[model samples]
Target: MKILVVGGYGVGKTTLVGAISEIEPLTTEADVTEASTDQDRTAGTEAKATTTVALDFGRITLLRHGLQLLLFGAPGQPRFWFMWDDLATGALGAVVMADTRRLADCFPIVEYCERLRLPFVVAVNEFDGSFPYLAEEVRDALALTERVPIRTCDAREPASVQAVLITLAEHALALHRAQRPLTH
Candidate 1:
């Protein structure tokens, strides 16, 4: 199943895709502005020069059932929202990464996934060691469900990134099962 990694500009969508992608990812990199850097990167990612303009694509093989996942990173801009629906088709689920600096950036993506009734989990990418706020507070602010897993990820580690995919798969399987019609 394909999974869409979506978030706002500089929100680590590309990094997330790159981290989990078993194959080298295909990404659209473009120059970023100083204004947007604060919202996207703080310290660890300060060296950032280019940002994804379109999407990032790659694949990963799951340990369970040898299931394979195609990861797609959404462009962080609203204009690219047009491609979001298409990218999401047939997706098992999504990991919508968020930044504490700009929590609002994640709202649209989260709402879109919900509207589509797609299973999704939120990951707060730590640009630096410090979190401006607590995870519970952020979850409250987003009004996310208790069952929707929220966790932290570095976006540079393959093992850590794979955990996100595994989590989504669990949620997706549950979602589909719940939607199955009851037998008479």
Candidate 2:
């Protein structure tokens, strides 16, 4: 399965990819300089010293189903959005990571997936402690339809990241089955 992992700046897209990947992930990360910060649209990412300049690539093999997943993570800054289309192309599905502190940052990614009719799951990256909102509350805030699944996880934890992937895989399968015509 080919999947794209995307989210806003400093939302843990790269961390999630690295935690669960069986192989050493390929990342085009660069030091965040003053110039780089100037280009960022949102605030509170000052603590982030490095940013994914191009993309992050990783691979994981699901032992249960013997399925191999190719994960591509997009750069979060708006300036790097040009790469999003290329990364998204031919992807079976996508996972949009969300940070409760800056919830609005995920809007673009959500809209992109919806516009392209790509199956996706919204994973709220719980930082340190849990957010005040429930999954339903986040769904309502993002205006996500019932078809989209909302999950909360700590991206730094391997098990949590793996669970998110599992959820995404199940969602993709259901989407595929629903789209196919019934056969005798």
The Cα local distance difference test for each model comes to 0.81, 0.91
Q: Quick one: best TM-score, which candidate?
A: 2
Q: Which candidate wins on lDDT?
A: 2
What digit string (tens of lDDT, one per residue) describes model 2 on residues 1-184?
Answer: 7899999999999999998899999999999888877778557667788999999999999788898999999998889999999999999999999998898998988999999999999999988654567999999999999989999988889999888888998999999999999999
Which residue pairs in candidate 2 have backbone atoms (N, alpha carbon, C) closer than 3 angstroms, thus clashing?
none
* Candidate 2 Cα outliers beyond 4 Å, as residue runs: none
Q: What is every candidate's alpha-carbon RMSD to the true fold? A: 3.1, 1.3
